[model samples]
Target: MAAVPLQEWERGDKTNVEIIGYGWRVLEYFHAEEKRVMVRLHLPADRDKDRIQLAVMLMLRDIKHSRKWLCEFCGAPARETHTFNFFYRVLDSDLPRLVVYCHFVCDMDKRHVREGLTATHHLMNTRFDGTLGPMPPFASFGKRPSGKVYPLAGSCAGCQHEDTAVDEGVLKRCARCKMTRVCGAACQRADWGRHKVACGMIYSVTFENWG
Candidate 1:
């Protein structure tokens, strides 16, 4: 999804490019114009946040990048992205963290916040409602994005061991959540304290085939 934009950013007349994808968070340091593009995202009144202030934007030139976005609903290439501010913050500013995107299929609602300097729902009308409520923590996106390429196998949560040496092919999934796997009862015991918190949050997604 970001391929064309990267190409445009590198070869087109503009020195910088801007987009708004709805599902991911926003990264500050884009331009003030991009900052203003936030109002249209229709994010829930309360989005999650965190404390770490990221500095990757300042070093954009030195960083190797490979982020390409897709439409959450249609799975098509996306151009513009949406906005939402998760946990990160500065002293007194609202720095949006996640992002959502839209293609030409949607129409801009033609709205702005605070003298067109900030963004609000830029586009909303589409064949179907593409708006998302709020982004979840990066941990719960379900079966990591690379799960297909690298399906996770049972590893001892306690000692982080990976071999079974037997024919059972890894230990059974944790009984409660049916997601976590451990090498044996003892390892599960050692890791129980840490895994409990995450186990409660690991409910499967509604879509069976989703990653």
Candidate 2:
């Protein structure tokens, strides 16, 4: 995580925090008591960061709806008192933000997630909250995403079939992300449901940056 400079701000002051992986900004103020000010931002994308953000949003919503806290990642009892409000979609007038308490262990090295997602053309973010309760009913959080394992350079994203495998010479790459590879059309089709979101978002990024 990029170090959030706070030399200018007084403690207990409300601030705005931008959730962009590449920058730092204030967002919301989670009160000393459990304000549980979880945010709901309507957005779309399919990179690792996007995937991870989606995962977290569902979790926060689960916590808010349940009115309790559990460790979002490790399923441990989490009572740490630290919070962050990450707002990703800035173009919109209503920037949704959430400030939830998270464990130091779970919240450490967030920058790694951002950089790793960028390098792999994947996307994700991790900010853990120690909200303990029954395991969330995941079905309510929309379709569970398929496994997003990063395949080898020449392996099939669907079946993990390698280029050297019989009848699998020269894997066909997804033109959208230019990153995902598969053994053939069969494997490509198998992976479509999983790859489509990331593929579209990545290509959109490239399109936006065409200069």
Candidate 3:
């Protein structure tokens, strides 16, 4: 299994510490380093906690390699699977930022329930409070029953349209930020004045050019 960075453990981010705490006892068997805090895994006796430890290790190993959608709790790969994608309200004015985690392990532990519709449904519909109630009638996972998904595509910073280079080949991604997509040269030129500041910030972070 991969090893987590000591720096990350030292940082003591609440979420990070919670995940590490989950499997810390099992992890200690593999690494002999002393730690400031430790918590035992609460899996059934037959179920090994090594898998959880490995998942956490892999997550820390890849944190700086570009993919940021990995499980926020256990560090498992989250994107192409049955992930629980929701938001925790962090700011008063801003829309909730997306948090994704593997449905089977991370979400189950947080809800303190075994695998079932009760856990999955709660993850999709409700907020992050630790409550286990019946699944609401209107709750549906993936694209909804109406076959519509919100934020259909990346909005063009130039035209403010729900289209992007991935969905529309005509659009080209911004050369600097690589986040903004524009319909054409005309749109890119029109948006340049307003986008420059954000573009510089994004470029600096992406390339690790900050000094």
Candidate 4:
């Protein structure tokens, strides 16, 4: 389990987190010092930006990473909150819907659960609010609210994969040009090498989005 930085926990910005393992769709950020857990979700690629942002805001209000289940109160997407009795189970239910996900954990004791779904219910009961009713054996924080986790936006157009290189964990450079592949590195490299110097200058142009 990799340790999360202080700033990331204090300030939520996954620009420095490394999510190599734990499934392609899942993400986990660990806080060793305080034993805190941050939950994140995988947003669909084809979703509209406005809808995605709305889902994210809803997740924040309910402390959920994504909108896996619909709320009983309102037709709006449901999220996990400290007020629920079976919070952990509800949280786990949200994962399969999202393609990518992850969270921070302490030990194997809490790791073991029925299909990894019950853990969310347990965490909610214990951490969100102090209600010893039907509690599971674990560490602490059955009454405290867990940290917020958000879906990471943006990807490298170069590889077409969702993985990011900002954390310095995996330095993926352009395979053809041997330069950092931020976007379309392979295509740019091929064109630059064979197209001559004059041709290369043609692509050195930039355009504004709103202008």
Q: Count the backbone clashes (under 3 Å) in each candidate.
A: 34, 17, 0, 16
Assess candidate 1 and give its lDDT.
0.30
Model 4 spans with C-alpha error above 4 angstroms? 1-114, 130-211
What TM-score, computed on C-alpha atoms, does each candidate reach?
Answer: 0.29, 0.28, 0.28, 0.21
lDDT of 1 by residue, 128-178 (tens): 253423333323523323322221112344554324312233555567755
Candidate that beats the other on lDDT, 2 or 3, i.e. the better one: 3
TM-score comparison, 1 vs 4, better candidate: 1
Taken over the whole model, the C-alpha lDDT of each candidate is 0.30, 0.33, 0.35, 0.29
Tens digits of per-residue lDDT for model 2, 32-56 = 2222222222234322355445544
lDDT (C-alpha) at residue 77 in model 4: 26
The predicted structure with the larger lDDT, 3 or 4, is 3
Question: 84-131, model 3: which lDDT tens digit per residue?
Answer: 323232122132121233322223333333344355556645664643
Which structure among the candidates has the greatest TM-score?
1
Worst lDDT 10-window in candidate 3: 17-26
Candidate 2 Cα misplacement greater than 4 A, ranges: 1-52, 55-154, 162-169, 204-211
Instruction: Give the per-residue Cα lDDT of candidate 3 at 141.
Output: 38
Q: Which structure is stronger by lDDT: 2 or 4? A: 2
Pick by lDDT: 1 or 3, better one: 3
Q: Stretches of candidate 1 above 4 Å error?
A: 1-46, 51-153, 165-169, 205-211
